[model samples]
Target: MSRTKTRFAFVCQSCGFRSPKWLGRCPGCEEWNTFAEESERVISGGSSARPAVPYPEIEDLSLSRIDSGIGELNRVLGGGIVPGSIILLGGEPGIGKSTLVLQAAEELSRQGLQVLYLAGEESAQQIKIRGDRLGLAGKHLFLASETCLERFLEEAQKIRPNLLVIDSIQTVYTESLDSIAGSISQVRECAARLLRFAKGERVPAFLVGHITKDGALAGPKALEHIVDTVLYFEGERHQNHKIVRAVKNRFGPANELGIFEMTGQGLKEVDSPSQLFLTERAPQAPGSAVVGAIEGSRPMLVEVQALVSQSNYITARRESNGFDRNRLSLLLAMLERRAGLHLLGTDVYVNVAGGLALSEPAVDLAVVAAVVSSFRNQPLSAKTVLFGEVGLAGEIRAVSLAVTRIREALAMGFKSVVLPANNLPLAEGVPKVELVGMSSVLDFMEWAG
Candidate 1:
C-alpha cells in the first residue's frame, strides 16, 4: 500500500492545539482566528527511522561548557553555555536580540572557537555591514544567509563550528513541510531538526524567535519545551537599557536576569544595576519610594512611583507600567478599605523606574507606600527603603530573602528600611541599619503620615 505524501490539520497558533477541522475559537487558549491549516509529510515503510543506539553509562558521560565571553549573557545562561544545548532566544523586534547574539558569536570566535551563524532574515551583506559597525569581523566567524533548513543543516555539518546560531527559527523552513516559513508546522519541524542536530553533533545552538501580538513566542508552544533554555530579551526599543532573563533552564536556575546598556559600540554589561536604576531618582519627590527586589539570586534596589489625583471622568482611571494592573487595583482597594484612604474619585498611575518589571510580592508595600504618598503629597525619606507583602486583610507579611534585601539597601546608603514586623529578626547582620517594622497597612499609613 502506498502512503500519502502529505496530511493537513488545523493547529492553534496560540496554544498549539491540533484539530481536524477549523473552529472559531481555540478550545485550549480561547483565542479567536488563531487556528491555521498546517501540512505534514506522511512517511511509509519506516524508511527514515534512525537505528537505535545504546544509552551511554551515566558515570562515563561528561558535560562541557563554553563561555560566551559576555558576562551579562553568561550569567543569564547560568554561568556558561553547555555543549549540545538548544537555547531559544525570544523577544520583541528591535529589542537587541540579533545584536546580542552577534556580539556573543564574535566573542566566542575571539576565544579561538569557530562559530556558524545562519542569518535567515537578513542578507550576507547586511550582516557584514552590522558586523563591521560592531567591530565583529572575526576570522573564525562564518555567516550564511539561508532559510532552507536542510541546506542550513548541511552547511552546519560542513563547518562543524563550536557554536551555531539561527538568526531566527521562524524564518527557516523545511522542504518536507508544505507550510511556509514562520508557520506553526514549519517552526516546529525546523526546531525539532535543529535540536536533534545539536544534541547528536554536540554543538551548542541558539535559535532566535519572534514574539506574537500577545507577547508570546510566535511559534508553537512545543518550541519552548523542546529547547534546553529559554531566554527573553526585554526592554523598550527607545530605551538604552535591556534585560536578558532566563525563564526556563534545565541545567541551571531560572528567573536569572542580566542587565545591559545598549551603546553605539554594542551591548555593555551593567555591573551595578541597582545604582543604574536609581541614578536619576529624585530624592525628595512625592509619590516615589525605593524597594529592594531579588531577581533570581541577585538583589537590587528599584524605585516605585505612583500618582493619585482627582478623576475627571465618572470611572476613575487606573494605570500601571512595569507592574501588574490587577495587583494595582487590589492595592488601591486595600488602601481605601484597610488604610482608611479616600480613593474613590481618584485617578492613580504607577510606574517602576528603569523599565524594570517587578512581580515580587515584597514590592506590594512599596506600591502601597508610593500610592499613599502621592495621595497625601508627602515625600518619603530618600534614605529609606522598604519591602514586604501586603495581605488582603491589611496585614503586612514577611517576604523571603529579607536579609539579602536589607544588605543591598544598606550598601546603597539607605539607612532605614520598612519591612514586615515578623522579618525584623532576619536582619541580624545589619545592626547599623534602622528597621521600621509594620504589622499592618494601617500602621504603614500612620508611619508614612
Candidate 2:
C-alpha cells in the first residue's frame, strides 16, 4: 500500500490565486493580506484514461417554472424560478437576504411544493423564531441544521425535495477538503458538488452568498460563473425600500430590478416603486430633476439631486452616490467645455434619490440638468421629467423605449417631458403631455432659463 502525500499552497481569498508560499499581497487581486494557506491531497497513481461518451440527443422538453408567490422576486428572476437551476443570492449583512429567502420558501411551501432549507449559519430554532414571526406555517417547509455538504446531500436525496436552499454557502463544507469552511477551496468544492446535485435531481436550488467588505461576493470569481443566476439584494440598512437587481441570469434576462419594502411583518412587494421613491421629494428645491428611467421591462420615474459648492481645498471634490464617479467626471468635463459651466474650481456632488442606482445612459440629461440647476441656483419644473443621452458635443441623443418612458411620466402625472429632439416625432402621438425636445444641452439651458 502506498501512502498519499499532502501539499500545502497559499490561496488568495479574493480571486482564488494559488501560490506555493504565503505573501503579504496577492498578485491576482492585488489585495493585501488576502493569502491563506490551504492543504491539498495528492494521490500517487498512474494516469487512467476514461472513454468519452457521445453527445446526448436534444429533447423538446418544456420546463415549467415554479412561482415563488412573490411578484417582486419573480420579476427579478425574469419570471418564476426555473427547475433544475441554481440561483445565487448575495447581499450585505442585515440587508434582508435571509428574510427574503425565508419568505419565498414559505410561499413555495404554501403552494404544496416541498422545500428543504438547510440552515448552515443559524440554528433550527433561530430559523423557527423568524419563520413564526413572519407568520409562516411551515407545513411543507423542511428545516435542517446541517453544514456538511455530503450529509446534506444524503438527507436531501432521502427526502427528495422539490426545492433546496442553503442559507449561506459560506458555512457549508465538504469532507474532501482540509481547508476550513468559507475558504476559497471549500466554497469552490461545495458549490460544485451542490451544482451537480441540482442538475442531477432536477431540483431548483437557491444558494445564499456572503458579500465581502468591499461589496463583492466573498468567494472565488468562478463561484458566480458556476451558478445559473446571480441576484444581488441592495439597499441601505436604514432604508425601508429594498432593491433586488439581477446581475446575471441564464434562464432569464439580466439587469432586472425588483422592489420591495421591509416591514415588521416581512418584505412586502412594492407595485408602484416610482411613487414610493418620489413620495418625499421637495418639488420646489433646486438641484432636483426628475428622470423617467426604465428598469428591465418596467418603467419608473426617479429623482436626481446634485449640489455644487465652492471648494475649500486645493482640488475640488467630485462625489456621487448611487451613480458612477468616473461618469460624473466625464459629464463635468462636457459641461465645462460644451455647456460653458465653470465647475472646475467648485465641488460637485450628485445623488440618485431613494437609494436607487441608475446606470442607463438615458439618465445623462437628468444628471446634467441637476448639476447645472444647482450651479446656477435655479429650480427646474417639478412636473417636468428628463430622459436623454448627453453627448460630448453637448448633443441630446435619443434613448430606447422613448414611448415607454413618456407613458410612465404621463402616468406619474407629469405634464411635460424634456426629451431628445429625435424622440419628439416618436412621442408626438402621446396625448395630454407636452414634449420639450432639445437638440443640444445649450438649447436645454436656454429653455430652462
In terms of TM-score, the best-performing candidate is 2
The models' CA-based lDDT, in order, is 0.88, 0.89
Provide the RMSD of all predictions against the true structure, rounded to 1 decimal: 2.3, 2.5
**Per-residue error (Å), model 2, residue 8:** 1.8
Model 1, stretches more than 4 Å misplaced?
A: 1-4, 44-56, 59-63, 220-222
What lDDT tens digits, residue by residue, belong to model 2 across residues 340-447? 899999999999988888999999999999999999999999999999999989899999999999999999999999999999888899999999999999999999
Model 1 deviation from the true structure expressed as Cα RMSD, one decimal place:
2.3
Per-residue CA lDDT of model 1 for 1-449, tens digit only, reads: 54658899998877678999999898988888989998888655644667776777332212467889999898888888888889999888888888999999999998999999889889988888888888986779998888898998899889899999998998999888888888877888888889989988989999998875365545834587989999987656778899888989987899999999989888999998899889989979999999989987799999999999999989999999989999999989988998779999999999999888888899999999999899999998889999999988899999999999998998999999999999988776687899999999998888887
Evaluate model 1: give its TM-score.
0.94
- Compared to the true structure, candidate 2 yields what TM-score? 0.95
Evaluated against the true structure, the overall lDDT of model 2 is 0.89
Clashing pairs in 1: none
| Model 2 per-residue lDDT at 407 | 94
